[model samples]
Target: MFDWLYVLMKKLVENVFGLSLDTGIGDSVHFFFYDSVKIIILLGFMIFTISYIRSYFSPEKTKEYISKFNGISKNVMASFLGIVTPFCSCSSVPLFIGFVEGGIPLGVTFSFLITSPIVNEAAFAILWASFGWKIAVLYVVMGVVLGVVGGIIIDKRKLEKYVEEYVYEMQMNRPDIEELTFKDRINFAKSNTLEIIGRVWKYVLVGIAIGAAIHGWAPEAALTKYAGPGNPLAVLAATIIAVPLYSNALGTIPIAEALLMKGVGLGTAMAFMMATTALSFPEMVLLRKVIKPKLIANFVAITAIGIVFIGYMFNGIAHLVI
Candidate 1:
């Protein structure tokens, strides 16, 4: 479907600018244009479609629905719900608090928190576009599993004491939800599409620019030597390095693509992406407003371990999928 975009970029680089496709700079420029345009178009369309579908599931409605479920089923439902809601880590905090106030288990709330930023529609669309459906499906499945497992661990540990006392005492006032017509839903989707694209466009450009540079100039030998499948610690190093630096999955996907092209191990690149999106420092800071420090630490530690495990698993089976 996007072959024309690649051909057009090739012509623009080689014919219009007189740069040969054989040169590194020419290939880098083509990559930047092709990926940037392709991601933007895919992002816009997916965000609109998702926002439209999301219009039906308000936070109030979601809380009510999840409240009906119990045990592992609640965690599973919450994680699946997280996939449809396009909240980044920090943005997910407010809904996290709402879920807490609504009497949802801390573990189930954590499930939603973990999955929302890591595996939304935007990430799925970009992954499918860049790496084919097999990898995209794998990513989504892994993300959900991580969420569910993390939630179960937290629940099993009975870590509710780590949550702030005020959270339990505060009463939540349920506001009336306004009914929307078809046109209203369309407008909401349009506005949401524009809002999200406006927010993440710069990240997309910067990510693609970095990816382009790596695509054009980075040494394959160095990448393979350090972060390749042969390096047992590659996934661990990737995950550790990613925690302090934050970006949404959309931004990180391009870098992941670049790393893959440079022969970086599949597990290492994915671990980096997951840690960047899900274990960000700013997110921890925001989460601190509601939860105590120990719970925060537990959340980080559990989620990080799950991400690393998934990374290794992916690396082990990469050939079968790729």
Candidate 2:
């Protein structure tokens, strides 16, 4: 549906503007315009749909479900809930604090934290739009697996002792908000869709602009030489670089698409996306207020190892599936 729409839009733009969509600046323009429209349309629909689905459940319900699980199932439940919880990394600290104070295990909370930023629906939407369902499914599976494994490792180490003493002592008093009706949910979805698209469209444009420029002007030889699947260190390099950089997954998706178009390896692109979203210096710094440096270091190290493994694994198998 989107491909046909893109073709029609491209033709319309060409006819309306008296420009070609196949060559030089026109090619770049068409790529940017087509991708921008496609991504925004997908983003709105996906966000609204997910938000409407979310209306069926509440945060209290999610916590209840998370608290009920034990062992590996606990990690799984927490990680899955993290994807649907609708909180950004910065706001997650308060939830984490509340969970810990309410007697939820540290490992389970970590599971939630690990997956929340990494496997969001916005990222999923863009990945689906840019790379298709196979890769999108792969990304979600790997993200959840990373969360589960990281949580289990933290559980084994009995790292609850490493959490800051102050977190347990602090008391929170939150007022409950009323649940929304179906009509309210519809309104909420509309507002959320607009708000998200309004905030990120510039990033999308910038990313696509960079992508469009590279698509038309950059030399594929240089990109292929350095970040190609054949390069043994490309995945590692991408993962390492992404650790400190800070960008939302939505913003990074277009750039990753561009990199792939310019001949960067699939694994390398995946690793970069994982690193930027899953692990970041600011995230670590924020976490330090609640967790000791040693545990924080372990979290980073373990997550990085998993991300690198996924990068290499995907790079090796991407050609087979893609």
RMSD to truth, every model: 1.9, 2.1
Candidate 1 C-alpha lDDT tens digits along 153-226: 99999999988888788787777778999999999999998987898888878888999898999999999999
lDDT of 2 by residue, 1-322 (tens): 5878788768866888677866767777777887888888778888888777766656566777888887899999988887777767687668778888777888888888898889866777888877887898899889999999999999899988889999999887766878778799898778877887887777777888887787767788999998889898998888888877666456777878878988888998999988888987777888888889999988999899999999999989988767
Worst 10 residues of 2 by lDDT: 53-62
Clashing pairs in 2: none
Off by over 4 Å in 1: 86-94
* Candidate number achieving the greatest TM-score relative to the actual structure: 1
- Candidate with top lDDT is 1
Error of 1 at 287 (Å): 2.0
- List the pairs of residues colliding in candidate 1: none
lDDT of each: 0.86, 0.83
